[model samples]
Target: MLEMKLTITAPDLSAAINNLAQTMSARVPGLQNGTSTCAEATNTTSVGADAVPAANPIQVTGVPTSAVPVAPAPTSVPVEQTAPVPTAAPAYTLEMIATAGTALIDAGKMKLLTDLIARYGISSITELDPSQYGAFATELRTLGAQI
Candidate 1:
């Protein structure tokens, strides 16, 4: 990054500043040495009566004082989502299966429930299909028989 060192308090510095102003005025036409070019930038040329006047007339270069319009929220979602329904055993659902498994887990046998789940080569209780829930529950209940 480029750096600039300017000491305004130094008595001899005023002459250097004057020389810079004179050079800018000579090279850049219409940009007067003393007048503020920052204030002159705010023009109501394109904007109408509703345009808000800036609180600060002078702004950082290349930045507009006007409010830019907000982008509207997305109108469409990427994926089409529908509720999962079991074709067979219409009365039972995935929620019921999850509840049953959670009951076993909550009864101080979380390891037993997870081990039974692993035996079926499934990672999560939610992965058990609605039709398979009855058999899965029966096998899980057999853990009590080991006692």
Candidate 2:
């Protein structure tokens, strides 16, 4: 139910019609010329019906009553595609954990460090599971140690 209007004015009617028709024909492929008698005289252009519905008609102003049937420009609908994002591997390493633990102990947090390792059911860094290195490093950072 949307209405759009475009106006093209020229000194000569035949020149305007011919110009518009030629432009349309060059831009659109597989277009068919309408049954307008003036089309034969001025060599009217053809337009395709693809992406354009025949139900909604175009009205051209400032032209003879036998104005060639006008069709709106073809349009394309874009399809959205989503791609899976790759997750980076954890950067935790045993050396990194050991360094952070040593730093914490040197900074007078020996009791806190021992308590943290016990909470993970480990008596020492060597006894801590490899898979738990990331969590362990995170806890070490919370204790003012850089890892």
Candidate 3:
């Protein structure tokens, strides 16, 4: 009669167990489908009468009975891209318009300013809508006002 005992280290246990399962599956018919009556194991291992040698029954200690498959890493990672935000032009202020109007008046171009304002159906600068300030500013610029 002969006896043998093999001890596996903690780090090597996983690899050892995998190799053992492959060997057992090949040797034992019932272990091929990962099931047996001798002992229960998760995903890979199974034990039965034919799984163990008559002279030496293998024993595994301090190891998890389950085998978890690791997922493969992605071939290429996706990168998120963002478009640049459009910057809005500054809104024209009433004070800006007043400065331009005062400049035109001081330059003796009050008629030109008044005529420009009148073209927009407005008799006075105060009567002008805030939204029309941009167009008014552009006109005042053409009339030589430092708006």
Candidate 4:
């Protein structure tokens, strides 16, 4: 025979009793039914027909208790996606050289042009169309001058 004292505190008395029943059932094997309630046979043994049992019966008492309120489940939010940035193309162009030359001439860059023609080739410039120049226009011009 085993004697035990159990005190259960829960938000409600019924919940506490339910918890206590489960706990008692687990601790005392074969003493409780599937529902955690003591079997009629065990209850009868505690209070037999002839006389009261010798050992003090297991007592389960419940007291009203409080617990911190649980917060609600968090809401899921969708994120906005941004498009990828485009890569910039190379800066060198035939038009850039022609434009630079024209600007230099306007700003008294004749000496610069003469040096360029000497260093590169002037004949290359003759092959290029005045309306359209590419990245190698200056080199072509220098080459043309040399030829």
User: Once superposed on the true structure, which residue ranges of model 1 sit more than 4 Å away at CA?
Assistant: 1-92, 144-147
Model 3: lDDT equals 0.68
**What lDDT does each candidate get?**
0.56, 0.68, 0.68, 0.48
| lDDT score at residue 31, model 4, on the 0-100 scale | 54
In the range 13-98, model 3's lDDT, one tens digit per residue, is 45666676666666554444452222222222224433443332345432334342478886987788889785975588989999
Model 1: clashing residue pairs?
Answer: none
TM-score of 1: 0.32
Order of all candidates by lDDT, from best down to worst? 3, 2, 1, 4
Q: How do the residues 45-139 of candidate 1 rate in per-residue lDDT, one tens digit apiece?
A: 22344444443343323222232348889798679789888686435456766676677767788898888888878899777766686677667
- Across 38-122, the per-residue lDDT of candidate 2 in tens digits comes to 2222222224432333332333333333344688899988888889685875678788899898999899999999999999997
lDDT of 2 at 144: 94
Query: For each candidate, what TM-score against the reference?
Result: 0.32, 0.40, 0.40, 0.26
Query: How displaced is residue 107 in candidate 4, in Å?
Result: 2.2
**Model 3: residues >4 Å from true position, as ranges?**
1-86
Against the true structure, candidate 2 has what lDDT? Answer: 0.68
